[model samples]
Structure formats: structure tokens, C-alpha cells
Target: MINMSILKSLGLSINPKLHVTVLTGAGISIESGVPIFRGKGSMWEIPEARRLAMRASPPWNNKETWEFYEWRRKLVSQCKPNAAHYTLVEMENYFENFCLITQNVDGLHIKAGSKRVLELHGNMWKGRCMKCGKIIDLPETPLKTLPPCCECGYPLRPHVVQFGEPIDNKILIEALKASKEAELFLVIGTSGVVSPASQMPILALENGAKVIEINPNPTVLTPYMSLSIRGKAAETLPKLWKSFFTD
Candidate 1:
């Protein structure tokens, strides 16, 4: 259990008016039956699948991408919002200035009713036209065709950033700014190995936010944590919320 006294001493309260930003990874979704890709001891993740998402020939298009995304989309669609997700929504409601920055493209945060979410990686449910750049929401049901076509007759690709693709500068800028501006920042369920995502909490720390990490195991960034609460997010978050944010 997290020692609330230690956190309270750091100015955490039932309701903080301060700006709060949370960065979440796959571990939070495990209770929803979602496989964690980037956590400590995770067996495997999306790399193999992402590679399959790309095409072989000249254009190097996301030829098989549709296959992977469709499978992924169906997998995610089966998962529901867990307690941790609901707790974040409650936190968002309590904190006047709050933002959720998630590395997972699973779309659970939005589904859980968090309004100010920045999906650092785009959601699988969205796709962009390879030809005209028109982005659209993909259907939950199986597509009739392999690679869906855009209104312009061009192949569409999942909106998610490919492995080698640099994060969209605008999104990175927003996440960084949020980290700097936050008075309290939470890193949840991440192993802290991935770039950019791993860097956000450090920015929050340097900028003087009370940085907290909630994970089942200590990660590389554990050394820098102002306070580390070791536990699975599904179980820990709701308890933390009840302890700190409830009447």
C-alpha cells in the first residue's frame, strides 16, 4: 500500500487545485485483459506486428498494416475500462487543470471519459488516407477489404506512428509543455525504457513537479522518483483514489 502520509507531506490532498498530468502505459490496461507490451518482463509486444504492418516493395507502404490494425482493433475492442481508468477520470474531474498523456494507442482513456487526453501514439481506431491525408474513424467490425481505400481511392494506413517514425512534433511539444507546467505528475505502468515517453516525467521532475510512479516493479526511472508506489495500477489506483480523493 502507498503511504498516503508521505504523499500528503508532499502536498498531495483529497483535491488538489494544482495542475496534474499523468502518463500511462500498458500495465494499467492489464486488468482489462490487454497485453502489456512495454512493461518490465513483458513477453512481447507490437514490433513484430508493426513490421508486418509495412509493405515489402518500392513505396514501402503500410500494406499489411491493415491486417495488424484490424486484429489489434478487435483485440482492444473486447477490453473495457477498468478501475484505474475510471480513477483517472475522477482525478481529471477533481483537478481543474489536468491532462492525460498515454503511450498506448488502445483508446481506453478516451473510452473512460478523460477529456484532456493526448494519445502520444495515435489510436488504432483511426486511420489516415495515404493519398490525401484524410483521417477517419475506422469501423469496429471487420472490414470487407484488406487495405481499406479512402474516398480518394488511395490506400489508408493506421494513424499510429510507425516504429521508425518520429513522433509528431506538435504532440511532443504539447506533452513536454504539460510536463513543465504540471505541479504534480504521475508515471503509471511504464518500464521507463521507451524514449520521449520516458523523458516526460524527467522533465516534470526538473520543472519541480512532485513526480510519482505507480508500477508493479521499479523501473529505470525509479531512482529519480520523488515517491514510488510499487503495485499494479488496476488494484493500486483505485485504492489511491479512494484514499486521497474521496470524502
Candidate 2:
């Protein structure tokens, strides 16, 4: 069962004067109908995205990967931001200094009206030029055929960092900066088990940020958090925000 007393205390403790940095993961979007890629019975792991992503080999770069990703794009393209997303937006609006760093590539937070967002994993709405370093914008929905670059003729790939790929330095630097400067770090939906992303919460904690974790299940970083609200973000965030600040 969820503890409302803890939630009340957390709300009371928040200092609106301090900067708030939120790090989000795929779990938040699961309620919006996107697949949770890493959790139990995840179908994405069956094909092992890491192998293909490492070299951009067959299946990763081939027609199959394109078809598969197109299906994923179709699903993501149809999804809309849920209550949790709106709650974050409201939080940002209320706070003078607020930063959101998300691990998911679905682009829901941006769609939900977050002004300052650092996509730790690059967005799926964009395409990358394989031949050149240039980025190409693509339709949010899947294209009928492989997309071509404007400057170069090579096939454009999803802008996201697939398994085995490194996170973009620019995004990483921004996240690090936010983590270092944040006085209140909120980790939502993430299990804190996924590599470098998991490390950000710890870095924020080390930098003297008060950490608050929101997840249905206990996570590796739970011990370090100032409060842990065990529930879905969609249900919990809005309640927390509404209880403190009225519309």
C-alpha cells in the first residue's frame, strides 16, 4: 500500500526556491501504451537489440530492423502524453528552475509541454545520416520506405541510441550539469539499473540533492532516496501535485 503521510511530508519539504531535476525512464510511458523494453517478459530482448545495434549489422540496419522499428514508430506515434507527463509539466511551470532528463525516446514529455527537456536517449522523431554527421528530421510516423538524407544519399537511421551505442555527449553533459546543480532530484518510473542513466541519481545525491524515487517496485537506488513512493507515476504524481498546488 502507498503511504500518504510520506507523500505529505515530501510535499512539505520541497523548497520551491531550489532547482528541481527529474530523471525519467520507460516505465512512465508504459501507461501511455508504449512497451516496457527491459521489464519481465519484454519481447524486445528476444531479438537481442544489442548485437544488431553494436555494428549496425543485418537486422539492425537491414529491412527487418526497419520494418520492426516502423512498427514501434507506429505505436509510439499514436501514443499521447498521460497524467504523469502533465504533472511534470505542471511542476516545471510552478518551479522557476526545473529540468527534465528522460531516458525514453518516445517524445511524450515534450508533447506534454515540458519546455526544458534533456533526452538522455535521443528522440525517435529524428533521423541520422550514416554517411555524414548531419541529422535529418523525419515524420513522426513510419515512412513507407527507408528515409534518405538531405545532404547525403545514405539511408537515415533512428536518432535514438540503440543498445550498445553510447549516449550523446551533449545530452550527457547537460544531464550532468543539471544533476550537479539540482537541489531536489526526482527519479520517476526508472529502476535505476540501466547503466549510466542509473548513475545520474547517485551523482545528484552525492552532490547533496535530496532524492525522491517513485516506482511500484523497490530499486537499487531506493536506499539512498529521501522518500520512495511506491505506485504508478500516472496515479501518484498528479495526486502529489494537486494536493500541494491547486489548478
Candidate 3:
């Protein structure tokens, strides 16, 4: 359990007028059974999977890429938002100024009823035509082949950012601006290794926001956290929300 004193400190930090920014990652979605793709002993550590998500020239041509994504889509289709996701949604209702920025492409945050969301990574359930750039909502039914565009007759790819592709500049700028303006910042379930997502906590700190980090393990950003709650978000968030709202 996280120290009670830390929770008390966080409660003291909250102000009715302050804007709250929540940064989320794969760990927050793990209760819904989503997998984390990074760090030691992870699935993406496999050379083939890494090559598939990383190397240039359409890794989908490789059976491993196709099979992996197919399985991933299936898993995503079955998963639902867990308690931690809803806790953020509840926070949105209580906090007049709130921004939810997520590294997850699972779409769980939106499904959990978060009204304002900034998806740092693009979504997986949507695809775009390679040739004409038309967005297509992926069918709930899985497809054996890459889905083709109705308009341009070209193959479609997941809207997500692949390993080598750069993040959209407009989204990055918005996330940065949000972090800077927030008076309360929460980093939820992320390992804090991914760049830019990792940069947000520091941005918040420099701008005088109190930083609260909730993760099961110690992370690279642990030392900088004003309050570090050590637990899975599914368990911790509901508890923390209880402390703030029902205590």
C-alpha cells in the first residue's frame, strides 16, 4: 500500500480552481488484460516482433507482423475499461479543469466516459488508406488480409504510430501545452521511459504543479515524483479517489 502520509499531502495540494492533468500508459490498461510491449522479459523483446513493428517497408508482409497484429486486435476487441479508467472519468466530473492524455491506443479511456481526452498515440481500432489517406473504422470482425480502401483501392494500415514513424507535431504541442498549464499532474501506471510522454512529468514539475505518480514498480521518474503511490492503478486509483472525495 502507498503511504497514507503521501495521500494526505496530495489532498492538501488539491484546490478547487486548479486544472488537473492525467498521463496514462499501458499499465493502467493491464487490468483489462492488455500487454505491455517494453522493458525486460516483455513480448516485444522477441526479435521477430521487434523487426515487425520497427523495420521499414511494410512489416505486414512478414507473417509474424500479420499474426501479431491480428491477435492484438482480437485481444483489444475483447477487453473493456477497468476501474482505474473510470476513476479518471470521475475525476473529470469533479475537476472543472481537466485534461486526460494517454499513451494507450486501446480507446478504453473514451469508452470509460472521459469527456476530454488527448490520445498521444493514435488508435488501433481505426485504419487509414496508404494511398489516399482516408480514415476507416476497423470492423469488429477480424480480417485475414490487410483491409483495402474503398475509395483508392489501396491497402489500409492501423492508424497507430509504428516504431520508426514520428509522432504528430500538433498532438505533441497540445500535450506539452496541457502539461505546462496544469496545476495538478498525475502520472498513472506508466513506466515513464517513452520520450515525450516521459517528458510531461518534468514539464509539470517545472511549471509548479504537484506531481503524483502511481505505478506498481519504481520507474526512472520516481525520484522526481512529489508523491509516488506503489500499486496497480486498478487498485490504487479507486482507493485514492475515495480518499479525496469520500474521506
- TM-scores of the candidates are 0.87, 0.85, 0.84
TM accuracy, model 1: 0.87
| Per-residue lDDT value at 190 in model 2 | 95
lDDT score for residue 7 of model 3 = 41
Candidate 2 regions with alpha-carbon error over 4 angstroms: 1-16, 45-63
Which residue pairs collide, candidate 1? none
On residues 1-247, what C-alpha lDDT tens digit does candidate 1 reach at each position? 6545544767766456788899998888777887665445443456665464453332323556577667667777899988899999999988888989999888898899998889888877777787798987875648777677788888777778777778878888999999999888999998888999999999999999999899988899999999889988888888766766433
lDDT of 2 by residue, 156-234 (tens): 7777887788899988998998998888788999989888889988998899877888898999999989878898999
Candidate 1, residue 68: Cα displacement in angstroms equals: 1.8
Worst 10 residues of 2 by lDDT: 52-61
* Candidate 1 colliding pairs, count: 0
Report lDDT per candidate. Answer: 0.80, 0.78, 0.79
Ranked by lDDT, the better of candidates 2 and 3 is: 3
Model 2 TM-score (2 dp): 0.85
Ranking by TM-score: 1, 2, 3
